[model samples]
Target chain A: METTTMIGQLPEVTYAGVIIKAIIILAVISAVAGFGTYVERKVLAFMQRRLGPMHVGPFGLLQIAADGIKLFTKEDIVPQHANRFIFMVAPVITAATAFIALAGVPVFPDFVIPQEVPLLGGIFVPSIASDVNVGILIVIGMMAAGLYGPLLAGMAQANKWGIIGAARTAIQFLSYEVVTGLSILAPIMIVGSLSFVEFNNYQGEHEVWLVFYQPVAFVLFLIAGFAETNRTPFDLLEHEAEIISGYATEYSGMRWGMFFIGEYANMITISVIASMVFLGGYNDLWIFPAALMIVLKIAFFFFLMLWVRASWPHIRPDQLMWLCWKVLMPIGVINMLITGIAVMLVLE
Target chain B: MENFLAQITTIEGFAFYLFSALTIVLFWITVMSKNVLYAMTALASGMVLISGFFFILGADFLGVVQLIVYVGAVMALYSFAMMFFDATRNIKENNTNSAIVFVLGGLSALALVLIFAAPIHNESIQALYPMHEGVGNAQDVGIILFTKYLIPFEVAAVMLLVAMIAGIILAGKKMDNSLTESMDEDVEDEIMKRKDLK
Candidate 1:
C-alpha cells in the first residue's frame, strides 16, 4: 500500500541539509514577500492607470529596502491604555505562525549540495523543512493558530476600532477555516495522502491535476484561501475605510511591518499549497522544468490575488459569514462526499 | 556549521527538558495571570507546547489535531467571547474560603502526581504494536480509529453533534427572550390603559 521505492531513489536526508534548507526557505521567502508587496503596488497601479513607487531605484525595485528602513526607524508607540506585554507579543505571533506554516510547504524541489563544498559537503535537502506525513493538516493548523495574533492584538490595544477589528478577525478566520479544510478534504481523499509530496507524486504519475478532477473543490479552496489570508474583498478585518487600519490601527514602525510580512508570507504559503495540491506542483509540464514550473504557478496565484484586490470591493462582514457557511461550506461538503463515493467505487 | 548540524541531529534530553520547562511556565502563566486575556493567550501557548510534546512522541496526527482543535478553534472562540467582557477589572481573589480550597486542591494534585509517579517508575510499558514503521502518520491513526475504536469514535462524534445543537438552541432561547421582553412592555401598556378605563 505504501511505496518508499520512489523516495529511496532520492538523495539521503541529513541534518545539515535540513538546517540549510530552513535558512534558505526563511531568507528567500522573506525576500519574496517583500518583493510581493512591490508587485502588488505595481499591479494595483497598472490596474488604476497610474505609476507606482518610481522614486526608489529602477522602477522602484529598491522600494522594499526603503520601506524596511523607514519601518525600522519609525517610532514604536504603545497606546497609553493598552496592555503593553500582549500588544508587543501579538505581531510576533502572527509573523512566527505564518513562517511556521511554511515549514510543511514544499517551496521548491529537493536538491543535493555538492561534495565539493568545504564544510557542508554531500548533504541532501528535502523540498520541505519537516516532511511530516500529515503535512497539509499541520500547515492548516499553524495557519489557523495565526488568528490569535490579530485577535489578541486588536483587543489588547484598548482602542474601540481595534476591538471591532479583533471581533471581525475572530469571526472571519474561524468561519473560513471550515471552508478551507472541507474544500481540501476531497483532494486529500482522492490522493489518500495528506503529505504534499505524495499529492505532487500522485499528480505527476497520473498526469492529471486534482483540480481537473475536483474543480469545485479547487474553486472553494481558492476562495477560502483568499479569506484566510485576509486579502481584499474578504479583508474586512483590516479594511481601512471601515475600521481605519483595523487590528493594526495602533501598531507602528517595525511592528506594523511584521503584520504585512506575515500577510505576504501567508499569501505565498497558500499559493504553494494550491499549486501543490491542485496544480501539477513541482511536476514538469510540457518542456518546462519542474522547479521552474512550480515557481511560475506560485507567481501566477500571487498576481491573481493582487489583481482581484485591485478589481473588487470589500464585502460586508455579514456577507463574508453568509458566503462561508451558507454557500462555500455546503458545496465543499457535497464535493467531498461525491469524491469519496467515486474513490470507493473505483477501488471496488 | 557541521558541529551545529551534528548537535541538532540528535534529539537529546535537553530538548525534552526545554519543551517541558516551556510547558510548565506557560501553564503557570495561564493559571496565575490576573488578566483573563493574558491567561487565555498563555493557555493557547501551553496547548501548542503540549502538541509539541505529542510531535516529539511521533504522534504527528494527534499533535496537529491538538493544535487545530484546542489552540486554533477552541482558544479563538474563547478569546472572541472574552472580548465582550471588560478586561480592565482585575479579578480579586479575596475569598478566605477560596484560599483554603486552593491549598487543598494543590495538596490533592501533589498526591495524584505521587500516585501516578510510583506506577510509572515501576512499570515498563511497551506499545501493543510498534508505531515507528507505519504507512503514514494520519493513515495509521485513521486505521486504528476506524477499526479498533470505531464505536468510541462514533459516540464522540454524536456527542459533539448534540453539544453543537444544544449551543444553538441556548443562543436561540436568549434571542427569543429578548424579543418577548420588548413585546411585554407593549402588553403592559395596554393593560394599564384598561385599568384606567375601569
Candidate 2:
C-alpha cells in the first residue's frame, strides 16, 4: 500500500518491477486455478462420501498436473459448421478478461525484491499491476465484457444447445451485472472512493469491516459474484443437466481447459474483491500477518463457494432471472439507498 | 530512423497510435463485414478501443464507464438481439446509387469535421468545471455531474429510462407465446412467404 519509503520515494515503480509482478500474477494465479480444480474435486468428494481422483497421486494432489497434461495433449476439435475464428478466439477472451480484471485487483501486498535477486533486484513491485483510480469499475467492466466469451463460443459453434447456452449467458450475465454493481455501490458510497486500497484503508480507519455496516451488500455481492463466475446453483450458462454443457458442448481439449481456468480465475478474483472490500483486505489481524490474513479470508470464501456448490441444487433459468431482477437487485438498490441516507445523516 | 523510433516508442505515444489504429481497423470491419456477428464484434471492440482515448486524456472514470456501458452492456444487448436473426448469413446491401451515397457521405463527413473544428477555432471555449489538481478522477466526474451538469444528466437518464421502457413494451408483445414453438411456426411461415414472393 505504501508506494514510497523514507528513502525519498524510489522511483514509485520500475518497468521491471511491473513486468515481474505481471508474470508472478499470471503464473501464480494460473497455477492456483489449476490447483483449485483439484481442491474442488476433493472437497466435493469428501462431502459426497467418495474418494475423488485417488489414483493420480497422494490424495490426488498430482491430479491437477495430470489433467494439465491431458488437456494440453488432447486433440483440438472444431465443429464442421462452426465459425472457426470466433470459436478459436472465444476461450482466449474468457481467460484474457479474467486475468486483465485481476490487474486492477491487489492480489498481494507490495514487496521489494532483494538485491541478491539478479535481474529484478532492488525493484519494488506494487500489489496492484495497474493502480488506476477506477479499480473497482475496471474489474466489473472486464468481468462484464467476459460474457462475450461464452456468448460467442455458444453462437459460433452452430449447435442448438450452444445457442441456447449463449442466450442464457447473455441474460444471466446482463441481469447479474446490475446486482453486482448495485450491491457494491453501498460500500463505494461509504468509502467515497472506487479504489480497492481506499476501501481497505477506510475499514482500517474505522476499525470495522464494511460487512458489519453493509451486511446486505455483502450478501448481495456474494450472490451476484456466484452468478457472475457461473458457479453451481447459478451456473445455468453451462448447466450440463439441462443443455449439455451449454456453451461448451462443442469445445474440447485446451480450449475447454481455458474456460475452466477462466472460471476458476474469476472465482478467485471475486473472492479477493469480497475479502478486500468487506473483510479488511490484507490488513493485519490479531496474531496473523497481513498477507496470511488475506490469504485465509480468500481461502474461506473459495471454500464457501465449493461448499455451497456441493450442497445446493441448480435453480431453473427462469427462477435465476426472477431472483436476480425481482429479489436480489431490489435488495441491492435498497441497501444503497439506506447507506446513502446514513452517510448523509452522519455528514450532517 | 532512430529519432522516429524514439518518438514512436514513448509509452504514451505508442499506446495512442496502437489504440487509434486498432479502433480504425475495427470500425472499418464493422462497416464492411457482411456477417452480422463479425460486425457486432468489431463494433464492440472499436467502442472499447475508443475508451482508450479517454484513459489517455486522464479520464479514467469516463473510460471505464465507456467500457461498461458501450462495450459491456450495449454491444452485448446488440448480440442478444442478433440471436433472433440469422446472424451468420451475409447481409446484402442495395448500393443502387453510388454517386448519391458518396455525395451524402462526404457532406456528412465534412459537416462533422467543421462542427468539431469550430470549437477549436473559437478561443472563447472554456472549461465549465475546471478539474481541481488533486481530486480523483471519479470524484471530479461526480462533482461535475451532480453540480454543474445535473440537469442535462437527469434529462439523459430520463431519456434512457424511456427508451428502456419502450424496448420492454415492444419485446413483451405476445409474451405468453413459447419462443421455441413460435420460432418453428414463424420459420415455416417465413419460408412459405419467401417462396410465394419468389
Candidate 3:
C-alpha cells in the first residue's frame, strides 16, 4: 500500500511522467472514493443498531462491489425523449469532478498515496506528482463543478419536478459555497500559504490543531460542510417528498451509481479535509501512530455526519438558505476575522 | 531515441487522443442527445477534456481550476438548470442563438490554438515549465489579487453579494407578496385620489 517510498528522486521520468502520474492518481482516488460508499452504508447501519450487509461477504465489506455489479449488470436506460449526450455524460462529470478534487489533497505526509514517500519508512517520497499551489481554490472550484452533474441529470430528465430539483440544488450550492470559502480563511491565514504542505506544516508546529484555537470556526466548518455535502438538514437536493431524489430521480442503474458513489466519496474527502485542518491531520495523537490518529479523527467526523443524519430531520429548503446566508455567512466572516487576528497576534 | 519517445510520451499522446475524442464525441452527444440531461453531462465531459488540455499545456492551476470551477460550479450550475427544465427536447434550439454560439466557440478554440502554438516552439522552456508558476500559484496569485487586482476582487465580492440577494429573492418564491408590499403605499395613494373623484 505504501509503495511510494520505494521510488527515489523527483519522479522525473520522460515527458510521459505527467500523464502517468495523473492517470494513476485518478484511478486510485476513484477506487477509494468508490469504496467510501461502502463505509457510509456500513456506518449508517451500525448507528441504526442493525446488522449491515451481513449477507454480503464479511460484514458487508464487499457490499460496494456488489452494488457496482448490480448497477453494471442492470439496464442502461435513457428516456426516449431525453437528450442522450448530457444524460450519459452527466454522471461522468459528477464522478470525475469529485475524484479530481481529491488530487489536490495530501492524505498523509510525504505519502498522499501518490505524491512523496517518507524515505525513513522506506515509503516516503518528496515528489507529489504536481502541486497546485492554490489547492484550496482548486478544491472550491471543483465543488462547483461537481454540482453540474446533479443539475444536468435532473434537467435532462425533462420532468418538471426534475427541473425544479436541479434549480434548487444550484441555488443551494451557490449559497453554501460562500460559507465554505469563508470558513477556510482561518487555516489559510494561519499557514500564510495556499500550498497544502505549508498548511500541514503550520499544523505540525502548532501541534494543538486549529480546532482548539478556533472552536467557532470548527463549528462553522461543520455547518458549512453539511451544506457543502448536501447531506441531512441540507440535502434538499434530493428531498424525496418535495422533489424526489432531486437530480437523481430520473437516473437509474449505473447512471445513478456515478452520483451515488460520488456523493459518499466527497463525504470522505470532506471528512479527511476536516481532519487535516482542524484535527492534527496525520500527526500522531497522544501515543497512537499518525495513521491511526488520522483514522480515528476521520471516523469520528464521518460518523458524526451520519449520526446527524439519523438524529435530525432534513430542514426545509428555505431554512437551509437562510442558515447559509444569514447565519453561517456572518459566522464564517467573523471566524475569518478572529482567526486572522489570532494568527497576527501570535506571529507578531 | 529516448528523447523522441519522451516528446510524445506515447502515454501522453494516447491519453490526450483518448480524452480529446471523448470530449468531442461527448460535446456532440450533449447537444444532440434528446435528453437535455445527457447534453449537460456531455458538456461536463467536454469541460473535463478542456481541463485535460490545460494539463497538457502545463497549466496546473488552470487545469485544476478548470476542473473545480467549471466542473464543480459552472457544470453544476448547468446541471441544476437542466434539472429545472426537462432537457428531453434535444431537436429544438436551446440557446438564444445557436449560430452565434457555434461561431464564437469555434473562434475561441482557434484563437487559443494560435496563441499557444507560438509558445510551443521553445521546447526546452516548455519542458522546464509545465505550468507558469507565478501565474497559477496561490501565493503569487494572492499578492497580485490583494495588490494590483484588489479592487476587482473586492468588486467581485460585491457583485456576488448582489447575486446572493437575487438568488434568495428568486428561490425564496412568493415574490408577488414582496412586490405587493413595496407597491402597497403607492396603490393606497391612487385609491385616495380615486375616492376624491368618486
Clashes of each: 0, 0, 55
In model 1, which runs have C-alpha deviations exceeding 4 angstroms? A1-6, B1-10, B172-198
For residues B28-110, could you state the per-residue lDDT of candidate 2 as single tens digits? 99988988778888898899899899888778889999999997899999999999866556778878789998899989999
Q: Which residue pairs show collisions in model 2?
A: none
Docking class for candidate 2: acceptable
Tens-digit lDDT track of model 2 for A82-119 = 88888899999999999999999998888888899877
The most accurate candidate by lDDT is: 2
By DockQ rank, best first, the candidates go 1, 2, 3
| Per-residue lDDT of candidate 1, residues A36-119 (tens digit) | 889899999999999999999999999999988999999999999888899999999999999999998887777877889987
Provide the lowest-lDDT 10-residue window in model 3 chain A. A1-10
Best by DockQ: 1
lDDT of 2: 0.90
* Each prediction's TM-score versus the true structure: 0.91, 0.92, 0.73
Highest-scoring model, TM-score: 2
**Which runs of model 3 end up more than 4 angstroms from their true locations?**
A1-46, A49-68, A108-130, A345-348, B1-86, B90-136, B145-198
lDDT digits (tens) for residues B1-198 of candidate 3: 677556556666767777877888988887677655556656776887888886664555567667766766676655544443435654465578879988999999999989989777866663322324334355544566798889999999999999989998887797446666668988999999999999
User: If both were scored by TM-score, which would come out higher, candidate 2 or candidate 3?
Assistant: 2
lDDT of 3 by residue, A177-273 (tens): 7778788877777766666656666787777887887687778878888887888978888888787677777788888888876786677778877
Docking quality tier of model 1: acceptable
- For residue A325, what is the lDDT in candidate 2? 84
